[model samples]
Target: MDLHPIEIVGRHPGPKILILAGIHGDEYEPIAAVRRLAGQIDREQLTGKVTLVPIANHSAYLRHSRVGTDQLDLARTFPGSADGTPTQQVAHAITGLIQQSDLMIDLHTGGLAMEISPLVGYMLVSDPSTLQKQRQMATAFGLPIVWGTTASLPGRSLSAARDANVPAIYAEWGGGGGCQAAGVAAYTAGCLQVMAQCEMLPSPAAAAPVDRCVIEDDRDTSGHLQLNYPAPHAGFYEPTLPLDSTVRPGDELGRLHDPFTSHTTTIYSTQTGRLFTRRVLPPVEAGDCLAVILEDPAETGTTNE
Candidate 1:
C-alpha cells in the first residue's frame, strides 16, 4: 500500500489534526474535498499542523470498489495485524497515524449504493471530557445533522481512535459511486471550519449549530433509531420521497419493482425520523440497504437521550 501524507506545519507549533478520506474507494466527495484542501490551504497561514490522507485504501480506490482485492472491507480492519491481508496492514498503518495525532476527522460517503445528507458523527466514549471534545468538533463541522452513537462497530476507524484515546469525528456526505459538485463543496467548507475550530486556521463567523440526535439501532431495544432499511428481494427501486424528507411511521418510502414478473413491493418507514440516506441506483440485490432512518430529535424527546 502506498500511503501519502500531505503535512503542513505552522511557524508556531500547535495541535496536530489528521484529516482522512476515501476509506471506501467508491466514496468520491470527501476525496475531492481533501484534495482541494491540500492544494488550497496556505501553510504560512496555518497555526498548527494538518496532515491529510486523500485516499486511505489505495487498492480498493484503484478498482473503484469498497473492499480490497481480498474482498475485505478496509474500514472494518482497524488496528490490524502486521501479518494480515493488505487491507489489514493498511489499517495497521492508519492506526499508527491515529495514535500520533491530537485530533482526527475521517471523511466518508454512502459509497456505491446510496446518497447521503451532509452530516457529522462522533462516537460516544466512556470519558465525558473526551465525548464532549468529539461533540465540539462535530459541531464545528457545521453540518445540518450531528449524530451521536455509543455502539462502535468492530474494527472501525472511530473505534480504533477510541482505543487510542483520540478525539475523532466521521463526516458523511454524497454517494452513488460518483462525485457530486455540491457534496465536494459542502465537505470542503466543513473541513475548513473544523481546522478553524482546532485553531489551525483563523476562525470565521461561527457556523449555525446543527440539529443534534442520538442515533440508536436495533441493538438497543429502548433506542428508536433504525439505521437501515434493507431491500426485501432483488429488484429495481423507485424512491417515493426525496432525500432529507421527514418521515412518519408507516410512510411509504419507495417501491421495489421486479421487471420480469411485474411484481411490486412497497417499502414503508418503520420509525418517525428523517431519511438521511437512500439508494439512488435502481438495481439492487437482496439485503442491500435501501434507506437509513435517523430518529427525529423532537420525536425522541431529547437530542442525546
Candidate 2:
C-alpha cells in the first residue's frame, strides 16, 4: 500500500488530532480550510499533535473528479486490502493514520447532487465513549446545524474509525459544487474550536455560547422540494429565487429556454419551505435539477431569503 501523506503541524506529548480533507475532489471547502489553518495556527500554542492530510486522494483531486480513477469511492473503502486497487491502498493508509490519533475530524462539503446545510454529522457507533466525545466536539463547534447519522455509514469511514477505537466526527460546511466565502469561514471556525475541546488549547469562559439542533436531518424535517418547469423552450437559464430562499408552493423560482429557438420555460416551486440549494448555471439538459425545495415543518426560515 502507498504510504499515507501526513503533515504534522503541532508537536506531540499532549493530545493528538487528525484533520483530514479532500477525500472527494469536488469538495474544495474543507481542503481550503485546512490550508488556511496550517498557515494560521501558532505552533507554540499547540499542546499536542495536529496532523493534516490536506489531500487524501491526490490522484482524483488532480483530475477534479469525485471518485478515484478506478471508479471507486475512496471514502467507502476504509480498512482496505494491502494488495487492493490504488484507491483501496489509499483508504487503508488513511485508516492506519487514524488508528494512531486520539481524535479524527473529517471535513467535507455538499456535492453536485445536492447542497446540504452547514452542519456537522456525528455518525453513531456502538461505543458510548466515542459517541460522547463526538457530541462534545460537535457542540463545541457551534455550527448552526448538527446532524446525527444514527448509525455508521456502510463501507468505510466511521466504521473504520470504530474498528480502530478512535473517536472520529465528520463536519461538513458550504456547498461543494459552488463556492461561498461566508460558508468557508464558518467551517474554519468550527475546526478551530476543536483545539479548545481537546484541551490542547485554552477553553473560553462561559460567555462562549453554542447552538444545538434537536435533529440533524434538517432538510427532511423542513419540507419536501418540488421542481417546476414551463412549456420548455429556451436560450439559457436565469433564476429568480436565488439560493437559500424561503418560498411557498406557487413561488416563481426561475426560467429556462432554448438558446437557438429563443423559447422560454418558467420554473416554480411546489412546496412551502426554503430553497436550500440551486443550480449554478443555465441552459441545462432536460431533467436537469434547477433548484431544490426544503420544506420546513414550522414553515419558516431559509438559509438566505
Candidate 3:
C-alpha cells in the first residue's frame, strides 16, 4: 500500500494516464524511460496528470533476475493480495493504480534472456470502445509492430485494467542485455506520443511507421511470448535466427547443445512468420523458452487492414 509513484499535474483538465515500467526487474529500458519522462513533461502546456511507476516491482528489481527473491513473477501475479508476498503486494498496489487511471501503458523489454523487436501490443478485449482506444494508442506509440492479442490471460496488469474498464497498452523493445539507448529514447517518445493522442500534451500525431505490421490475433496464446520454442534439453542455446528475420516453418530456429554432453538438438520454427524474439542467454533449462516466432498474420487470417 506504500507504492511511491511520480505525479506530473497539468494546469488544464483532461485524461489522467498511468504509465508503468519495471514490472520486471531485469528489464531496464522502461525504467530508464519512465525516469526520463518524469523530467521531460511540460506542465504549463499539458492537461490532466501522468502517474508513473518507474519500478513497479522493486522486489524483482533488487534481485536482478526476472523473478523476485520469492521467485514470483510480478507480471503473472497481478491484482494480488493486500498482505501477500512482496511481489504480490506490488501487484496489488499497481492494480489500485490501474483502477484510478483513465489510460495505462505498461512498458517492458525482453530482459536478460530474450531480444524483442520494438512493438506496442494490447489485449483483444471484448469491448469495442476499449479495443478501438487501444488500437489508437498502439498506433500513436508508433512502434514497428502493433499487436492485438487475446485478453483471456489473467494476473496481468492489462487484465486488471480490463476489469476496471480502462483501456491499456504495453510496449516491448530490444533486450537480452543492459538497457539500450535506442530503446530508452524510443519508449520516451512513444509515451509522449500517447499523451498527445490523449490530449494531455501538445504535439502532432506520431508518425506512423511506413512499414508497420499490425496484427490482431485472438488465439488463446497469441500474446504468450515465453511459451514458444521450448528447449528440448537443458543446455546452452545457440539461436540461429535473428530478431525480425523472416522464418519459414521447419526452419531451424536454434540449437541446444547439451551442457554435459556433445549432443545437440535443433529447434525448428512451427509457423511461417517473423522471428519476433530470440533467447540471448545461452544457459537454458529443458523447458526454457529459446525463441518466439510470431506467426504470420496472413496465415492466421488476423491482419489489421
Among these predictions, the greatest lDDT belongs to 3
Write the number of the candidate with greater TM-score, choosing between 1 and 3: 3
For model 3, how does the per-residue alpha-carbon lDDT over 1-305 read when each residue is reduced to its tens digit? 66689999999888989999989899999999999999999999889989999888787888888998889998899899989988888899899989999999999999998899999999999899999999999998988999889899888999999999899999999988798999999999999999998889998553655579998888888898878877777889888877889988799988889877889888998788889889999998888888887775667676544
Off by over 4 Å in 2: 1-6, 9-12, 176-179, 204-212, 216-305
Instruction: Please give each candidate's TM-score.
Output: 0.90, 0.72, 0.96
Question: Candidate 1 — which pairs collide?
Answer: none
Q: For model 1, state the Cα shift of residue 226 in Å.
A: 10
In model 3, the runs with Cα more than 4 Å from the true position are 204-209, 301-305
Write down the lDDT of every candidate, Cα atoms only.
0.82, 0.69, 0.89
lDDT accuracy of residue 55 in candidate 2: 83
Residue 5 accuracy (lDDT) in model 3: 97
Model 3 clash pairs are none
- Reference-based TM-score, model 1: 0.90
| Clash count, candidate 2 | 12
Best by TM-score: 3
